[model samples]
Target: MPYLSPADIRSKTFRRKRQGYDPGQVNEFLLIIADALAGRLRLNPDHIRTVRFAAVPNGYDPLSVDGVLHLLEFQVRNGIVPPTGLNSGEDLRARKLPRSGTGYDRAEVDAFIARAAANLDGRGSMTSTEVRNTRFSTTSGLLGKGYQVQAVDTLLDDLEQELRFRGR
Candidate 1:
């Protein structure tokens, strides 16, 4: 069982989307996470799990952020972060994109995720700059169903942060 290092939690950035949790509140909570992970704070897993962030415009994406929080909660309670990368494609592959409207283009998101994972594994050639700056087109009328765009972008942004931190 591998614990999530403070550095790992500290370097993460939540993606902001409309009507998400307030960034300031989330940041403050993340500080607690770091301290707790570093043995400088005492907090129960429920403290992280049940935390409420005030709503504000362009705040942290709720679903994406919740996923991270769940993982953190698991780590704190169980003393082991799961054996998975933050942006692992396995979960993404099993995700069912909402069909009510077009989200991010499916193929593009999948391809980029694969490439990003490969890049981290030293099997792909995308530079950190390229991964940080890469953009994908959106789905259009009847083109295809898609995943949530903000979620995917946030994931990529976090991946970019990881790449840059490693490069340094």
Candidate 2:
């Protein structure tokens, strides 16, 4: 069997012991080992996962698959998706709309964009629907009092800019 690199050993070693080496010292050593290994074998620390955001037809908005994936990951991290089968469409819909809430705030929208950006790191474009759905769902909640469904749609043009969506 090939010998493990020092970085590999360090990863395991770092996990143990109550009085481990100072973090700075340990990190310094790891960097040196990383450099040495970098010359011996190609390591792609910068490699990114490829994701494709599908297109949305004329007039609807929803999260792209990538955007959805990001939202799902965030939801999972926050215990919002539960432990299993979280990606099911029904489940996602449930999370998108709480039983009783005014709706997503500016912060929520910002968070959604940030999550999508992370999930689609190097991906080109995003589905128009994906962006719309996020807005629609959120707006639906925000416009709860004396808010007409049709009236909510009237704000789409303005909201689109905030969402950074490119209309198809």
Candidate 3:
């Protein structure tokens, strides 16, 4: 496989989808990744592997984003660009999901994420089934804001997988 360079990352583009990864988030992340590839920023393979973007209407295709991310992760792991620092140790529970005009209730999703993170860390109990079945109330209108539905659902899918791996 050809090694991807900072220029390649910066120049890459994806197809827009009716519902897909948020373009703003993906573009921002791409800039960060490109900088890291150029040794202008410090980021580890784990950061590349675990990165998630919000999903939104008229956004970049998720499959395309995932493919690029997979390649980046593989390249980083293979020493194409040596990582200069350790994981940031940021708490997943503190990470905020992007809000949308019509989406899941932010508070509900936040609470669920906190609970799920605790369960994953062995501080609480939650089942894969629970994660699979979780749902949040939607919010809309001029003043109301909420977490992006597809983004939260994507996170729930990851959490469910982890829970299952842990035999929860």
Candidate 4:
């Protein structure tokens, strides 16, 4: 299941509001919108499971698209199959992502680490608005909340550590 459906997102029904639109009708409409969007997105029954299992959850952030994509790319690069049901031709095609079964070069891995570090370091020195607008994309939703670059970098660090421990 998706984390939240479009209807759940767009629904007008919410906490009670004084002098607000009709709660019942708005909420119902949101649900409809969400369902329609969900259908269009082709969200699978296992989408939530896939995301949740991709990483151990922390209090602030859930696994994000970038994180998941990173993990998937890492797995592919290292020739390690992730510990979940992400292997399918349809899903791969749906994302329109390419996989040539080639691993990252040692130089590329080093460069990736350097880039992640630079991104994290720059975030520490930048203003909130700059970080929010230039660093993280809104497309990530809740996953794109505060300090997304840091989150992704931290995840990359963990992944790299795991890869090293595994003797990748």
Candidate 5:
């Protein structure tokens, strides 16, 4: 495999989609990763692994960004910075996402998390694709109750990885 340089990462671009990852967020994240790869920033593998971005209209394609992330993770884990690119829910029952005023509906997110935990423990069936496709109603207004969107999305990303690892 060809090695990826920090410059390559910095210059990478993704196709835009109607509904995808926020472009500014993705670009900022790429800069961070590039900096880390270039020894100008400090970021552990887990930090790269768990990073999340908001979804928005007219955003960068998610699959493209995710592919880059996977490569970056590989590079990070193998000490291949500038060369390569890249869960467990045990205690999922005890996991608590921070609440937000405008975010995913708490009830819906909790139920999904429960289901994900059960699936991880071999007590239920849930596919990575399902996790990837999962969506929840958004709570609106300052007083609205919900789970923090980033936290929930991050957890779901972990769960999806676990399921994929297990070939579920």
Candidate 6:
């Protein structure tokens, strides 16, 4: 959704999760965003950057979606259109996995996010080119289930696609 525009925000359909965002509240906010986009006005970019939410039962972590919104706002303000997911960059959201869970290893996943951020932000040596070809092995630990391999691989594929799009 980082690629969503103001108009896109207006037209986009958000699914109602049984326990996702408060539909009313999120929809209201989207309207504000769309209006601001239409008016060429910058709203609370700083607020969006720093905002956090209290998790509700069944409500998705608003941050997951907000992060994309923040990115979109930043790009719009800077007058740059971030290419679609297929274009450029290796950015990802990191999630912590329990030491004993059916999730990717917390350490490895975090490390990957760090690397992706660095590469995308140009703070590391790995070029976007390298990221496109990079691959990771599933983790091995004395205890706990690692993040599902398929899930992590899928994410990597997405990250790679982003990088490839950017590289192109």
> CA lDDT of each candidate?
0.67, 0.34, 0.70, 0.31, 0.74, 0.53
Query: Cα RMSD (Å) between model 6 and the true structure?
Result: 12.3
Tens digits of per-residue lDDT, candidate 2, 37-107, equal: 32322323222113222332331122222232343234323323112222222332233322223544545
Per-residue C-alpha lDDT of model 3 across residues 40-130, encoded as one tens digit per residue: 4577889988998888999999988898899888876664742212112134565557778789987787777767666656678788678
TM-score of each: 0.46, 0.19, 0.46, 0.20, 0.52, 0.36
Model 3: residues with Cα > 4 Å off, grouped in runs: 1-91, 142-144
Q: How accurate is candidate 1 locally (lDDT)?
A: 0.67
Question: Counting only residues 3 or more apart in sequence or on different chains, how many pairs clash (N, Cα, C under 3 Å) in candidate 4?
Answer: 7
lDDT by residue for model 6 (9-99), tens: 6544544344566645655666666545433346765655654444445654465566656765675466443333322234355433234
What lDDT tens digits, residue by residue, belong to model 1 across residues 1-168? 244555567667877897899888887788788656544458899988888888899888999888888888987887553233444445434444454246777778778777766666667666557865688777675544676665665465455545645661
Clashing residue pairs in candidate 3 are none
Give the Cα-based TM-score of candidate 2 against the true structure.
0.19
lDDT of 5 by residue, 80-113 (tens): 7431211334667666789889999988988888
Q: State the TM-score for model 1.
A: 0.46
Local distance difference test, candidate 6: 0.53
Best by lDDT: 5
**Model 3 TM-score, all chains together:** 0.46
Can you give the lDDT of residue 101 in candidate 4? 25
Compare the candidates by TM-score and give the number of the best one. 5
Look at candidate 2 and give me any clashing residue pairs.
Answer: 61-129, 61-133, 62-129, 62-130, 62-133, 63-130, 102-141
lDDT of 5 at 145: 85
Model 4: how far is 144 from its true place, Å? Answer: 37
